[model samples]
Target chain A: MRSRGAGTRTQLTKLEELLRELRVEEVMTRRLVSVSGDFTMAQVKELLRKHRISGVPVLEGEALVGVVSIEDVTRALEQGEMGAKVRDRMSREVITVFADEPAVEAVKRFAHTKVGRLPVLDRGGKVVGILTPGDPVGRAFRVMDLRYREQEQQRWQQKGLGLEDLLGEGASLVLRFRVQGEDFAGAGKASVQAKRVLGRLGLDPGAVRRATIAAYEAEMNLIIHTRGGELTLEATPHSVVVEAVDKGPGIVDVEQALQPGFSTAPEWVCEMGFGAGMGLNNIQSCADEFEIESEVGRGTRVRAVVHLSQSGRKDRLNR
Target chain B: MRLQDIKVQLEAEQVAGSPRPELEIKEACAADLMSDVLASARPGSLLLTGLTHPQAVRVAALASLAAVVFVQGKEPLRDTLVAAEESGLPLFVTQLSLFESCGRLYQAGLRG
Candidate 1:
């Protein structure tokens, strides 16, 4: 049980000495793709497709204003809660590294920090490029480990692909995908795909972001916190709806369920950098119209709606 | 007013998640949950809450709050207090209900 057959898959963490040898200037991927805070969501989507990056730094005339990730873009297309403003969902006060420092330091920072990207700067603080520790070779090995084992595969199992499984034939534009609940490896995939759907349909980015956050939270709720629920993505010309119904033991208190800090997830969730108890509240925060009904003995139903035509909203930045 | 002034109004105990004593204060907000407080609290404000965990401290850091007051004489967990200590934030403890504590601070010029 201790090994769980994870022997060959385990890769050692980088030592501090290795980190100390890493200089920010050495490993950074040069030629950053940046967007102004005023850039349209359509333009940002194009940038992601072109650069093949998960995020882009948002510049307010070179003050290093904020950053837009694939997650932000997805949220915009899904619910449009954050509006067309890039500053709304962008992470301000981005973590950074100096070129004179060791390259391994970037890896250490990435492992420790909540954010995924670090902008590299030289002595004078001019932007050099970026560094992302994504798709580590070790990870590819771990993913390959799960490829053959049926017992291990059960954790990430899916009944089928596409929305028809969760919602009947009446559901339109059925968006379907599997939840990597146990691994937490690809939890947001479903929501991100749904966001692209909205963008292609010319839905507002503001609405897209909101709906995506709510939907992602719900999907994560199913994957991480509950016993795993199914997702139903149904959209019409005027509104987008996400329905997540999980067969967990069901919520204990609807009132407390609506309140924040009301998480029942184990402590390791926090250790692994997931489950901040923001799941339910974040869902409530973004959706234009939200409804939830759960029975203690059975399951839970969360329905969220986002309109198609809402305009810009003032997005806040946190230092 | 500065943090030293607000120290006089607290219940004279160090609750677990309460920030340190030296950090400066500019305003105050009293809430138990993480979401609305994150959405509403201003920068450099003092936060009063019943939540005694690291997430609260994380929000406090993200919002750039100066101090966190634990009302009802509640003790913050070790992790929360440790985060506050690491952040060098001021921690204050008060033996009062959420309503009365907020009311007393409002009377003392700690505007919402």
Candidate 2:
């Protein structure tokens, strides 16, 4: 967990550093789909449709003179001016961004001008590339991902410590809470504390979120089902480990409990906006590694581990 | 346009951040529901809504909106105003209805 947390933090720092250092020329599309001034409005409209773009720069020789957008084309078509030349339909008073400018400057231009795209110009005032809002969004994601992988490689070099070695060290943080059965008020207290501690540690947001979700669901399960239980959270620089041990009413079918919509919770618990049978399933999904052991008559113990690394996939939409 | 321009055009009362009237506003979005604004409103766009609560201010900060305008003569609670001041988000209250406020902004060259 220590390596994972450190690795994620280093990657995030790198991303911010890269964003500050990046310039528009690093991400702007160089192969521009520009139209000449002599092109007819119908041909320009066809060009936009073929490229599936909202706008394009109008170039005379190597110099960009104006930009024709979907809005401009729509206005021309509405007025039965499809046969007009591109120069007439295009906005000559165009706002452009220099390729050497910081990428952040383009963001400001997009916001202030309310323009969908900007023609990127070189030092010679030549239209070298085109920039759109999608360029920045895509570039940020790509750079972050690449940096994450690079940090992961570095982590692999210093991977001697096991989970126990990191969690049992003098620098380890362990938090324990007694979760009383039927104590709805105190059910999520431990999870909230864990979230705060992890936040203070500056763990990756995705890891912190997963750890909190796992802790809360496990805590709720202890409160709503068991007699009483102890929830323990151990956080190191690289990982968060949660252990929940209860007294009795152990699960009879661990596989069934792991399935979605499988709950032993009562009606009142359901009415309280919980016990949708997703607790165990959610815990399993949130944790990188999950384990459960139960003796039908005696007790149950569940352990979950969330690695504070950038390898976690962000596919919340599919779920 | 600037916040001061919007204030004059819509006849809005400055609830907070009145001294920073030179703040630039490029686009405007009108929605009463906070969820809609969160999902649809772009960063730096002006938010025009009648809901004056702490959550509205929170949503504006989270979305990085330029400012919040309370339409239909709506006024925010004291706590909400305090939250706005703390967040450094400008707030205004206009007597005009949502439709009238949006129409005036559109006529003034503000996009959706």
Candidate 3:
């Protein structure tokens, strides 16, 4: 169950990492849903139904006074007091979260208090927003996704020189990138870059895909197994070559590592959907020519080549 | 089959990305391990998985998958949904187990 050199990084699951990084204010709903204290229970019930919400903060002017819920509304109706003021039926003691607090704190509060929502207060103790069970996680995902897309687009824009125009017949181009070890957050990036570059060069779609997949798996191996490494892509009109060279903590058994389901990745890494013992095999399968060289204490190097078929080469030349 | 018909057959909820009713999806591969996906899945195929982490969406994007469906009523983390939307990968959630979801899709003429 242990890969000789895997799981040496922090063990925080992705969700735990996100919760620590996100603040309550970033995730809370800023659109306030409130009912004045003077509103009758009958009116509160109608408001809840209209908004498709279970509860709302009760307010007196701009001051948060209490919270009224569907349960309270039901109780009022059962008691034949639908006309009772919200102030009388609302829960006076509220469990609140601060806008600046880590989202983890709000999650803990929810677990301990068993409440569906908490009013979010700013430093001045004024309610700024409402924190629901789903808000923090949902918001964190959105923010991270946006960041990922932006970074990818920025990389694409930065490499604006046209590879298509640069390479003539009998000329080849090389693109190199550094892969940081245990940097799971930045994994797969180099492959994406290579894929885009190959696509722009008008390589065959199948050849580009194979090279990209091989490069990705090799990039992942460098991140999971070594201190750090370099991913290099060399492309010509007829073939694409992907190479990964990493220093130290080399594989003890290169033959064993090539087998599917022979992963040495730890439990946590496996849970994250990696370390499945399939990276090497996957890389090998995608390449028309594959090579690996390793020295247990020195390093490991992998090279995979995907050749463009006759039709692919003709299509590239015609373009 | 069209993605819209597959959605109806699976009785799934579209959690992320806009629906393209006319989008065609002819193949699907079910897996929790991402490497298996990168190894075998064809481009434009649908991915059915129980893995709810953002990595699942990342792998789907890397492999050029047409969409992802989370089986067994498993809700993806908020980050996962956001990644799907940002990557322009459609996501769905179904109450059926993986076996049942695959069975229904297979019966409806979809292949792995």
TM-score: which candidate is best? 3
Q: By the lDDT metric, which is better: model 1 or model 3? A: 3
lDDT of 3 by residue, B4-95 (tens): 89889999867765345679998999999889999889888999999988878878877878899999999788888767766667788899
Please provide, for model 2 over A1-319, each residue's C-alpha lDDT reduced to its tens digit, 9 standing for 90 to 100.
9999998898777655665567777667655799999998899889999989999999899988899999988998899999999888889988998988887788788989989998999888988788898786567656565455446534532453333354554466888999999986445667766765554444554566667667877888899999989998887666789999998988898888888777778897765556677777777877889999998879999999987674332212111
Position A236, candidate 2: lDDT:
67
TM-score per prediction, in order, is 0.37, 0.38, 0.62
- How good is model 3 by TM-score? 0.62
- Give one digit per residue, the lDDT tens place, for model 1 in B25-98: 66788887555565567667888888766656655654556678777877766776666544445566677888
- Indicate which candidate wins on DockQ: 3
- Among these predicted structures, which one has the highest lDDT? 3
What DockQ do you compute for every candidate structure?
Answer: 0.04, 0.02, 0.33
Candidate 2 on B1-112: residue-level lDDT in tens?
A: 9988998999985665323467888888997655455445666789998777665765565455789998898767776776665555778888899999999999999898
Local distance difference test, each candidate: 0.64, 0.75, 0.82
- Per-residue CA lDDT of candidate 1, range A14-98, in tens? 2333345434543455556888888877678888999788888887766677778888888888986534777666778788887
Interface RMSD for all numbered candidates: 13.0, 13.4, 6.2
